[model samples]
Target chain A: MEDVYMGIDVGSISTKGVIITKENKILSSEYIWTEGNPIGAVKKLVRLLEKQFDKENYRIVATGTTGSARKLVGTVLSATVVKNEITAHAVGTTTFHPDVRTILEIGGQDSKIILVENGVAVDYAMNTLCAAGTGAFLSSQSARLGIPVEDMGEIAVKSQHPTQIAARCTVFAESDLVHKIQVGHTKEDIVAGLCQAVVGNYLNNVGKGKKIQSPVVFQGGVSKNIGVVKAFENQLGCPIIVDPDGHLMGAIGAAILARRNKERRVFNFDVEDMEFITREINCGGCPNNCEIICVYRNGEMIDSWGNRCERGDVAARKAANPNAAAV
Target chain B: MDEIRMPKAEYNHHEMVVGIPRSLLYFRYGVLWERFFQELGVKTITSAPTNLKIMTNGSRRAASEMCLAMKIYMGHVESLIGKCDYILVPRILDFGLRRVMCVNFEALPDVVSNIFFESPIRVLSYNIDVSKKLDERRAMVEMAVSMGFSHGKSNKAYKKARKAQNEADSRAVKQNEAKYKNDGITLVLAGHSYILEDEYIGKPIMQYLNENGVNVVRADLVDRKAALRESERLSPTLKWELSREIVGSLVMHVHDFDGVVLLSVYPCALDSMVNDMMLRKNRITHVPILQMTLDAQTGTAGVETRLESFLDILKMRKEVEAGNGREAEA
Candidate 1:
């Protein structure tokens, strides 16, 4: 049977899954909202992919997970590789566009800029302590403007002149947006202005000090917005390449990582029915009060972490399995 | 009859325990203080390392605009309340002109006192304002004298403590020098000692790097005299004492490190300006730089991602130079 790989990206806003062959060809893909429930989201995502995947023609040999909740989802899927989103995104993007020198990503609550040299990420930075110039910022503004986030991109591109708004912070942006609306700026212009603000904030914050070379690729959830894409293009004075599968790049990268990993394990869609429960406990064994997270599979303790000392480890294990002998 | 023979009650110096907050200048002078007290036959207690409860208490007590370091310091001070006889809060204004510390250091004692004015916690302090010709040894001696120690005894204890502190510092500097001989990816972690040594903020980053097989070098662990000289030559106008030391270390060891990680706490004006200047003035062509500004809300995941990607970049670069760039994918 042909060897295949599975990858899942469980992010704060969305869950994505993909099946790919050794040659990096996508056999099947699925994307859905996480809706604050990562386990349920992955189960739904995997089931969707299972329907599209050709099980008879290919055998899934490896699996990988990426994004914020990668560890939780990795355990759920028994992934062979659990990589961070930055490395995953870089690998995924470089695989497709080997010559790409810059990768700009704007996701739900975060944004990052990665500078690539010869297909390797040399330097990078992420938006710190603020969600000012991310997809979440746009969605919130979209709500205030009585316009859907998906529609804002279309409306933005139609503006003749985009009004300037303070993009230093979300609070400042919100007040400036309200002031502009009170002064009667057109909806399209305001929407376009918001997109510009995001680009400006991103550059001033995450993209600060980094050299932005040519062959730039923009991805993540925000890449779907044409308005922001145009804003990036205008600001950087270079053509921004947005792949059709840009949003799935994280999951695709994960799949590539699984393919590259030396370890091999048979991955099956049967995980859709496995009961995965995550329990967070404030371990009081020490003053650190580490919030240990334990993942239980079918009422059996699978894995646990976040304890600083052996006392915490024992406490977590004891909390999960009281009947088991103490270590 | 045996109890009746124990007629004379001797005065115990160990009863007056001085509580030292494990933050700010403690990282700089902790050994000195501990050794001084030990030499004087007095007992001392240091507040525990930064933890969730301490950080939360500090953030609640400090002003909204204060840097995270300051807030955490306040929390450490709060943790020592009622735990010891007196809490030590030193007003370290400056070592000398152009070697001045952050203004927060000058106000730390007063800030702690004012924040806990209603509480029954009494603050014990020493002044290190060199502009007024006051020095650390003299201040420490006077503090000890006020605590009922003889002038000569306090002076001798201070000298011994200073010597002990110097030896410990030299050991650290030597350890850093020895790490340079190791054949691996050496990254210079540049930050204030308070930020780098804190158990809550910096330890995990160091732990992660150590686990990943990277040779970690601390920028602040260099010889202060050498570092100061390098700092003066690099940036004559640079004023802050700690910033000068950091700049000097970075300048002196720039060639040895494969990469530099500029770690700073959130909203620290000194670090913000110093780091920006360093980034702009950095002339090294090959060394990759990563700036991580952490705050109360910073999670380990974000930091891990950055660090992992950084290691990848270094590995990929090394592979490319060796004509085996393909192995970077593994």
Candidate 2:
């Protein structure tokens, strides 16, 4: 039987799953909206991927998880390899594109620029505080412009003269874009300007104090935008490569990481009949009353988080064993 | 009609109890702390001394950017919240005697209040600025008056507390002096002794180094005159007494030690910036320097590894220099 590895990228916006053969061929993949429920999304993703591939043909060996929801998913799935997004992204991109020197990733909420030296990530910067150069920003702007988000790239391509928008911050860029539109700039010109502003903002904020060299691989959801890709190439004076499976790179990275780990664990992909429930509680430990989230399986509290103390741990343990004395 | 009875003014008679976290100013003014409340006829409850549990608790609640001391202090405060009626978290802006703590220290009460807004425990605070003739006595008197004590009684309490605090501080200074004179690689640790004394946060690092045969010296252990003079050499314009003392101690003893370890708490904006500047400007090329940031969640494993690596680097440099000297002689 052929061996298969499982990779899960449990992000805030979406949860992605990928099943790969021993030789790293993508056998089955699925993406599902998280909808603020990471556990539910992972369960759905696992069920979807399992349906596409025959369990008999490929024996599951190892599992890896990445992204913001990586820990939650990993805990739920019992993943063999749990890694940060940086390591997973670098591993995934480098495996496919060995000669790639840089990776520019702009996701739904965050943007990051990873500098690779001989396929190793030497330095990387992530913009977690701002939302200026992200997919959410673009989608909101597209809605404001009365254009479908999917049509933004194609419309931007039609501009004869693109207007220059401020790319300092989201507030500044929005006002600048609105001002440019008010001054009677064409919709296409404004769209093109918006694309340019995103690239500029990313380069200035996330890509600050770092050298961004080419053979750059632009991945993440925003990489689907040809307008943004063209802006990156124009600004950096270098060709940008966007993988056809760029949206699934994090998942792909996770898959590759799972394969690399020698530990083999049999994964029971039979998630169809699994019962899971989530509950939220407030921990009044100190002045910071942290709202804790607890996940239960078969009426047994499996995991709890959100509280910044041992309170969560005690609560989870107590919930699991009702007779246990409270700490 | 029944006659209503009010609460008695005697300290022993009072049912209301105040809790004090002995982490930050607790180190600086423990005697004054106990004395002031005692004189005011109020019961004071202090959190247990710094321990592993407190450190772990603090680290979990504090943000990633907060300094180790603040994190530990928060932990201490957390321990006292439910156990006491009110936590005495004074906001000492300035000493009025040219000594001012970091802005973070000044804003600690506000930070604690904001961080623990949901907690039922009340926080009692008083602002002190000696530069504006706002001395400790005046501050204590004001605190007492606010708590419903009469002006004459508050004044008496303040004087008594002040006297007790001075004696305690002097005794602590003497003990530290004795501890400083021991044999081995004498390191003059330059931060607040309170931070250095915390068992879980700062003390373990010192204990580890000492157990490895390196003698520990505290910046707080040195004579005030000598440390001040040494600080003048490093930076003539250095103002804060504690910082100046540390810098002075480093300058004076940099040649005597093999290496220097500068320990700072996380989110300490003043120390982070000033200490980095000191490390850059100092011309002590022969000695190695290690800057460690302490937070509530400081893993002993990581710190141990760093300390081991730093020590190895110094050892390697020494061996190389010694070999070079022998080769030149031959």
Candidate 3:
């Protein structure tokens, strides 16, 4: 059987998975909407990948996970490694584009800009407190514009003049968008302006101060928008490299990381049958009342966290142990 | 009904209660201020650590564009309103020429008073304007005199408070300096003492950094006079007192640390300038720098992920330096 590595990235808006051979050749991949259910989303993603997999030729040797729900999904899949989006994205993009100096990622809920030097991440900043210039914001605005979100990029590029929208906050931008629409501006102009506003907001907030050197790669769902890509190129005064599989970079990076730490172990796919549940309980062991979370597989406990004292460990052990009463 | 015994005084000082809002200046002067009041036979009370409700009240009172730290300070003041006979909010002006504070510090007293015009609670204020010759010591004495204390008592209390404040600062400096000798990786965190020391907003990052087993050092712990002098190398004209001191310490001590984290509260005009200056001016080699800005939302998960990624970078950098370059690609 050919040795292959698998990676899964369960994000806030979407979940993606990728399987690659030992030589880093893509075997199969899947991307699905999380729909607020990361667990279900991953299961669906895996099930789709399984249908596409040449099961007889390739055997999954190692698995890794990334994204915000990485820990949960990693534990469920018994992934060899679980990493954050920044590291995963960096590794994935740098592997494909070795000379890339910067990575600008705007996902469904957040935006980030990473500055790389000599293939090493030197500095990075992420948007905090607001989702002003993310994929979700663009999609919501598109829905209000009486156009499909996917069609925005095509419509946006048709305009010769793009209206200016406030990039400081989403509330003001939305109101300005309405005002622009009421003033009988062309739909194409408004669409193009929205893309420009996203780019402006990103540079002002996430890309503030830090020097953005080029050979840049833009990734995540927003990179799929041609209008936004055009706006970024125009604003940055440099063309951005967006790979066709940019949306799957996070998962691919996880796969590469898994391959880097190739471990010899069988992935228990049957464990999917076991019921996975997480429970949060306050440990009254001390005055702090640390909220302890226990992840259970079927009726037994697999892991627990948020315990400040030995009491939490004791509770976990008792739950995991068959003879001891469930705490 | 108080359990502690009271010291002998010419006049009864039991009714005197000084409320300190645990905001901007409180983090820097709370120990000395409380110690002074205690020595004067006056009781002292401070507002609770920041929470959502208090933050909301502060947001309601402040203009949206104001810095997060100032808004949080306003919230602290609001929390103490109607709860204390007098709330202490100092008007910290310039330390000296070209050494000015952010405009918020200079206007804090007026803002609070104007916002709470109908409130019965009196604001106990002390002006610290070294540029105008009304220094901190003089202001404190004047405040004590206005509070109806005798000259002799106020002098003695001020001296004692000064000594106490000095001792407290030295002890902290010594404790932090001790981390320099640790065998593990050390990272210098440059940020406001209030933001780095606050229980509600700052504690999580502090706890996270400490638990990672890396030796942590704070720029605030460095000697202020020496730091101010050290900062001249980076930018002679850059003169925000605490920021200058922090930059100076970073410049002086960046060699001893493996990395630097520039932490700031979002929308800070002062930090925005200083943070950029550090990125452009600091001539350190190979040490990775991360600029983090905290907002109202608890972006703890994202911050933690970034911190972990930073630790990974540090680990990888160390490995490469140690001749294990094979892992660099991995």
Runs in model 1 deviating more than 4 A are A325-327, B1-15, B145-150, B283-286, B328-330
Fraction of true interface contacts that also occur in model 1: 0.56
How many angstroms is the interface RMSD of candidate 1?
2.4
Question: Between which residue pairs do clashes occur in model 1?
Answer: none
True lDDT of residue B108, candidate 2:
74
Candidate 1 chain B, run of 10 with poorest lDDT = B1-10
Comparison by DockQ, 2 against 3, better one: 3
- The positional error of residue A90 in candidate 3, measured at the CA in angstroms, is 1.1
**Candidate 3 residue-wise lDDT, A16-135, digit = tens:** 999987667888998899999877787778878888988777788889999988888888788889998888888788778878888999999889897776676656777765788998
TM-score (C-alpha) between model 2 and the true structure: 0.60
Q: Compare the candidates by lDDT and give the number of the best one.
A: 1
lDDT of 2 at B227: 80
Order of models, best TM-score first: 1, 3, 2
Residue A284: error of model 1 in Å? 1.5
**Clashing pairs in model 3, backbone N/Cα/C closer than 3 A:** none
Q: What tens digits encode model 2's per-residue C-alpha lDDT throughout A1-327?
A: 877889999876778889987667899999888889888889889889988988777778889998877766877887888766766787788778888888999988778777666555544556634467898889889988999987898988888887898866677878887888888999999999999888988987667556678798998888888899898999999989999987788888887778777777889875546677777876555544456778777777778776545776666566567687544
